[model samples]
Target: MAESDAWILTTGLNNGVSKLVGEGISQYRLLRRHPKDVVCIGLTMWGTINEKTRIDLKKASQIGASDEACKRQIRDDVQEDKETLDPHHTHCILFDSGNLNEYLSDSQRSSFVQYVCDDKNSHACKEVFFDNMNFQQRLIEL
Candidate 1:
């Protein structure tokens, strides 16, 4: 349990562990009344997501891009190195390292969790990353 709001972070891929995370979120959402009660964030590397898919994501955020246009972009695509994002996630954060192949470094996720746990610095939001975690900012994540 957490003294403050909780967050769920994942790679956002529709396969493997990330896929399971998405399913869990779906079940949680079913019982919760408010949609914003929980935050499940999908963090992924920009290089992994396809170019057109990237565009669709951008447009999807703004004007609500048509489902058909988004479909056309991936019509000819064969599933290979690229990953399909889990639809259950509430938000997707694509990190661009400017490299063709890049993933979340341990330090990247670590630092972010640290910042969130450190309530003193996170004046913008008072969120407790985990139970055993305090202002000391130990490796507390979920």
Candidate 2:
């Protein structure tokens, strides 16, 4: 996608498969600059992020808060299933469902992705589905 300047979107979370995707994109950027810069975007539920990140984000969202006031830590929360944003990702979109433990369901994520893909201003020309892949499977695909 970098070669064509396409958008590389993933379920936004600095965990598991998504983490690997972020790392791969980071390495790709470091290795070459000829084709174009890759726009790797992550979209995930706000409640899924670590407690610290969530608190910071909420504070920054206050009416009078400055954008500069927010700073995300790149560490996982102590709580299981909580995650932080990947440092390597170019952008992140966090959807808030108002509950701390609630996250976007697979159906919701799919609908959101489809909505973006159908938009005229979408970054990628096509939708790329990603699944959890073992180390060997991912390496072989490359």
Candidate 3:
């Protein structure tokens, strides 16, 4: 793959889909002995429990502020928190979905798709929707 090529894996760090893909990427890299050539990016929604906790603690001093104020502060602070990536991942992308069930907007989806598939050489990419597939089926498909 060219330096511009990348593999975008959309899933949360703690979720089953992410684990499966991370493992697969690791194994494939090991087999080829060229880990640096494969860029595995994990994309996930912000505001997970783990993420909130870390952000809260980091901004503990501001907890006493008004609810709305605290919320705004947390939002601003979390935006700068770049350590959310899973250890096994090569890179990370976080989307600002207010709630867990919120789907990406049409433009967001299009931009993300373009980013992953933009490479001229056509690197392979897979998107696994956890709600649409059972764990066993996802593993087999991947």
Q: What is the C-alpha lDDT of each candidate?
A: 0.64, 0.66, 0.51
**In model 3, what are the clashing residue pairs, if there are any?**
none
Candidate ordering by TM-score (highest first): 2, 1, 3
Model 1: residues with Cα > 4 Å off, grouped in runs: 1-4, 31-36, 61-80, 118-142
RMSD of each: 6.6, 7.2, 9.5
Can you write out model 1's per-residue Cα lDDT over 9-95, one digit (the tens) per residue?
777778787788778778777866764456767777877776566777767676656665345344465554677678987777787
Instruction: Please give the clash total of every predicted structure, in order.
Output: 0, 0, 0
How well does candidate 3 match the true structure, expressed as C-alpha RMSD?
9.5
lDDT of candidate 1 at residue 59, scale 0 to 100: 75
Which pairs clash inside model 2? Answer: none
As for lDDT, the candidate ahead, 1 or 2, is: 2
Which ranges in model 2 have alpha carbons more than 4 Å from their true place?
59-81, 120-124, 131-142
TM-score of 2: 0.68
- Per-residue lDDT of candidate 3, residues 1-142 (tens digit): 3343444454536456676666766777777745456566666555543545445534665655455544443444455433333556777666776664343344664577565456556534444233223531111111
TM-score of each: 0.61, 0.68, 0.46
Q: Sort by lDDT, best first.
A: 2, 1, 3
